[model samples]
Target: MTSREQPSRKRPRSEDASLKNSLSDSERETHEDLIFIRPMRPLSVEPDRDDKFWYKDGNVVLVAGNVAFRVYRGLLASQSTVLDDLCSADPAWHVDGCPVVHMSDRAEEVRSLLSVLINGKTYITKREVSFEDLAIWIRLAHKYRIADLLENSLRRPSLQSPHHSITAVNLARLTETSSILPLALYDCCQLPVETLLNGHTYPGGRVEKLSADDVQRCIQALSVLGVQRTLAIVKSMDLSACGYSCRFECADHVSAIKTELLEDLKSPGCRHPLCSWARFMGQYNRDMTSNVKNSAHPMCPRCIKTVIQSHGQVLLECWKNLPELLGIEVEGWATAQDA
Candidate 1:
């Protein structure tokens, strides 16, 4: 049994890499004894060997979809005890003198998993991993009991990505990746209802959808979040009395801000009112560059002193109640700061 040494987890690594969408050189390579084929090109039931993963000295043939990877059994056995059992149990099924293990996963998924196992390009180490791709990796990792791979794949996804939509909440539910749920659901609430129902578009315009149950959850959660948004607005709406009462601009701006906040409640999405509000006139909306990010109501020193103080507390409290709002109970789920 040939083996490849696993990489050190403590090693300092940087520069995230992405899953390659297309092969660099020729998608296929020919050899006297072996021929390598890129997956998803479609092949016969017998399947074709992978262009990148085939090794001349491999002891096992792992078939996934219509593609195969001829790789060392010991290398896999070293990573996952579950894989070790599978590779050894089916010795009676052999291909070209190497034992065959047929997998139900898609060829592309197997390719990604093998790449991560062999190349050390994991979700955390990768520069950017889309939620869809990460979901796939996680499913495979769980199926195979690949502890390291599952641990890395389970790291919090980039909720800030526009493509991070309701699909994430659904995936989190399906994969039992609960830590991702609270924020993922919160992020979904920020989208317009049409967008939430239809889902966000990736670079290729691939739109992920939500399950009916999740759709219902989000709708219910949005209504609850809307109340939170209202409370935040009401908390700050009384800023006119803070020594700036003599200034008519303060009253005028407060009125304008109140109207905008009220409109947010009527809007089709979660306004994220607290996070978006600043100590300045960010609610009043004057100028972008000059107004400063998360600006306060103008010339109101009291607002400057206490706006974030109140909003930050509200944001934390909102996050604390998130799992309950979504109505999903996760084992050992704990609330984090402003998730």
Candidate 2:
């Protein structure tokens, strides 16, 4: 066979010299850029009598540059000052006046200013955010890319108190808006059902008038949004005080939720530790010889089929009476109104 053209002496290894040289140059440039840029962002500068920047809309500092913003500690304590600043129609030397300027080149400076504004405040001061003020500040921050400041401000602990009624309008305004804080998710999950059902209505119906379809939608929405913990919290709510109001308005949801829960229980690895004791105390027995959660003998499929073909009331009655017949100790299930 004609010898395949003797593989030309394998080209000697290139040693990645070109790649190594290019990478070294790139890394050097990046390091130089960071070193040069970081210091341009000053943490603090004395405000001149004719300061170029001014506080507008709470903590935001508006300067004459590309959508630049900063936070100021002293201005946050006064609402009137914030309002007056935002109302300034012709704020010279302010970002609002020169909104078209491109400040993307000075990102480091903006970060430094924001760090100064937010970090300067004490934890107690930050926690005192009202809904309206927070709404305004978050809007400005998002517009200017104040990611760190937004995180710090909204991460402050909040309690489930009636302090939200005053800010209802603001909360409603920001719904589904990207201008909202990431922590707003926490607030949404924490909001009282009473507050939600109230739905911008005051001095009237508290529990939302949920129809069958509305209940299905809310359940699906909550599931899709991955708020399982919140759903569990909702599941645990005690609605006994409202009596018929709760029964009529919330029954379908409650029943559907329980049905889903029972299916979940039937799945593998769904054993709820806290409810295990309660579950064990309610197991059905065939020969009436089982003690509790565990049954001594399994029943025929015909018995199961007959039970499945019954109404909710009949099923509940059978459940309640199962423990009695089989000598299991089960606390009778309470009604939706009692939940």
**Best by the lDDT measure:** 1
* Model 1 lDDT per residue over 235-289, tens place: 7666544554343355555656677768867755546744745634443343444
lDDT of 2 by residue, 246-265 (tens): 21223333344446555665
Misplaced by over 4 Å in model 1 are: 1-44, 91-96, 121-123, 156-163, 191-212, 240-248, 270-274, 279-305, 330-339
Best by TM-score: 1
